[model samples]
Target: MAAILKDVMSPNPVSSNATDELTTVSKKMKEEDVGFIPVKEDDKYAGVVTDRDIVVNGLAKGSAENVQASDVMTENIVTGPPDMEVEEAARLMQEHQIKRLLVMEDKEVKGVATLGDLGVENAVETAGNVIHDVSKGNGNN
Candidate 1:
């Protein structure tokens, strides 16, 4: 039996605008209790903003209010499809060194898949390897 991304991904993930203030995005992240948020521009998926990007790029620039999601968002994001195999998704995460992957359908944002989601599906080893690789700067660190 092949487990698909839609079976384990967090659907309809919280998102933000690329032009939004970093402070606003940070607040949303805090409120959502999430470390990452999808970024959109012109109603189209643009990139991803992570807590690290906030600290490293946003704060480093002086004020969060002065920073925009586009200023800190990772534009070259690796996305996956809803029907993708879990193992393949895990592999993509490992390859990208990213902890989360935006699940897209027809070029539209659909959901997100995290290493923890894989762990929840009993892919502990895969999740661990992903974490290790991402932590070691292999994914996007």
Candidate 2:
């Protein structure tokens, strides 16, 4: 049987308000020791802010203190159901050129699945393919 997303997802992911300043969000990322933070609005997941987004979008825009999490967050994020097969999730991540997928249920964010998590489950080949694809022309090399 194929492994499900929930079996490898990082549950109860850290989230931040959309209105939060980049400075605050950056601090939260450091405190949580995470590279990504889901952005919330009206008690629902809105988007995701990553360390790269902070540096590229927030810093490049100047005055990061005035930048909001929503300003740097990736709005059109890819997501998956908790019951999705790990292989399916890997396919989605590769198709979307992303490293993580938000696990959602009934429009509620439950957890996040990353390439590292897939590796932990011994899906190294799939994870490697995803990394290679996502890194293409993205300066990840």
Top candidate, metric TM-score:
1
Candidate 2 Cα RMSD after full superposition onto the native fold (Å): 2.9
Best model number under lDDT = 1
TM agreement with the true structure for every prediction: 0.88, 0.86
Model 2 residue 130 distance off true place after TM-score fit, in angstroms: 4.8
Candidate 2: residue 76 Cα off by (Å): 0.6
Instruction: Summarize candidate 2's per-residue lDDT along 13-130 as a digit string, tens digits.
Output: 8899999999999999899888888999989888899888888778998779789999889887889999999888877776776778889999988999987776545567756665
Clashes of 2: 0
Off by over 4 Å in 1: 120-137
Residue pair clashes in candidate 1: 96-139, 97-139
